[model samples]
Target: MFTDEEFEKYLKELDNPDLSEFEFFTESTGVKVYRRYNKTSGLYDYKTIGGIDVPVDTCFAVYTDLEYRKKWDSYVKELYQFEEDGKKGVYWRVAFPFPLSNRDYVFVRETREFDLNGKHIYVCLGRSAEFKSKKEKSGVVRVNDFLQSMIFTSDGNGTKAFMHYYDNPRGMIPTWLINWAAKSGIPGFLAKMVIACNSYDKYLASKK
Candidate 1:
């Protein structure tokens, strides 16, 4: 779904060392969050870095397994994969607190493995996509603008992970919700991911 030049651009941004444009948002659950303004969207983009004491493969699996994600992620109201015209896509519906409408997204995702400088890295890239066969549900806002990239690499006995995320959840959003996303939402999700990674082997065995 992405061109080679576009992928290279993403890699360049991931490799960028200039943190002067970003401000530290929070640090919790072994993850540090940073944010920078996106002039194009008039919103903020997030950068997250952390280490999990799990194998790199396990961590990557936990992040990519949609079935397993439904078990660990409470915010995931619905998630599944589909194929149309020989292309694969993902649909996700996120649950919001009371009185607020839920949000959904359709994405085209790709995963790549690279050996750079003798270090093995796994990257997951995703962007919003339009699928003619997918229909939107009533009362749920469709998030058409979303981008995410995750990088996982071995760090000694553990895995070092980084994420870059941006999305425009089109609709009316309150200040409190925005604050919660930055402070509690992201870290809480990562914390649950760690737990999921720990049990991923058992989960896989159950499937066999």
Candidate 2:
């Protein structure tokens, strides 16, 4: 569980990451991805910055609405929440491309809102969690190492999004393949998110 101060620290880090050790990876449209090596974990940490031409609240809604996620998140083969405790839960999933084994995560996610420099900001943090009731499923690789944070700030026109993600699949995958996917995958995901938010906004408007 992250305290309010820790969450605030994360937000500060997102706004100003120590780029000295990070290397530029790739960019698509307005999204840019960066990667840094973690000596302790022996894995790479990924960060992405991008702007979506949608309201901040809309973006947050699209992200947290798990039921609505299936429509836009093409990689999610299956997802369901279990053992919910407020914003925390064990979410099942089958992700990654074909030929690779599916992966599942037992994680706790929390969201908080605050004002930063007169702009409304929403922060969502997620990390792996363990429980006695949770167990790994058959034919799926359980992701034991995972941490993700998404910060959305309302700009005058739209929203600016920053994503910090770190995960290890715990398998015999090549580093090059993982790097390739991270570079290409994140921007595409952001693009899809923008489109999905727009679609959802239209859907809401039409109902009025």
Candidate 3:
């Protein structure tokens, strides 16, 4: 069967097709952002927050700690535990828009770039049991898959955050229906993420 991307391309061959997503990556000042949305596309693409930045420890702290996450983002129900990769990561759970739906995700420092001010990248390095809940088996998780990357970079002002979300969850419902719901809901959720990040950025800047 033809993949969604392949079908999209095929349709484009027949006639002009409206792009579901545009400008997969964004750049501003000392920050460059990347993101991807297709279920099977194992890449990162998205927007980055522009303007004054924050410190690496501060930013990472916000992401790794679920309690800290609630101050900034609005989607996490709980963070069960956090463990690092030889002292460079933490594991946690992030809730989705749907009920009893959450993802088992992990975060580990990937690399630090010396250019463009300074850059820090943390990816979803692993997952323990990506289950739907305590009542389910370790079947293919249908909430959020792996391949998500979260990056933080700095500039003369401070540091900017870049979010790279990946995953195409499969479950009882069809992917198309889930994609449709996500298409309708993700923008608002993303807006919340941006707002939370910016608010935290402001709080951090004030501390300096």
Query: For residues 101-162, could you state the per-residue lDDT of candidate 3 as single tens digits?
Result: 56545433333233322333332223223322333336324333444444444444444454
Candidate 1: the clashing residue pairs are none
In order, candidate lDDTs are 0.84, 0.81, 0.44
Give a tens-digit lDDT track for model 1, residues 1-208. 8776755655555446246889999999677889888776667888888888889989998999999999988889999999999999999999988888999999999988777766788888999999998788899999999989888889888888888888888788854467566677778878888889999899999999
Worst ten-residue run, lDDT, model 1?
9-18
TM-scores, one per candidate: 0.91, 0.89, 0.47
Worst 10-residue lDDT window for candidate 2 reads 83-92
- Per-model tally of clashing residue pairs: 0, 0, 9
- For candidate 2, list the clashing residue pairs, or say none: none
2 against 3, candidate with superior TM-score: 2
In model 3, the number of clashes is: 9
Off by over 4 Å in 3: 1-61, 83-91, 94-103, 106-144, 155-161, 181-190, 198-208
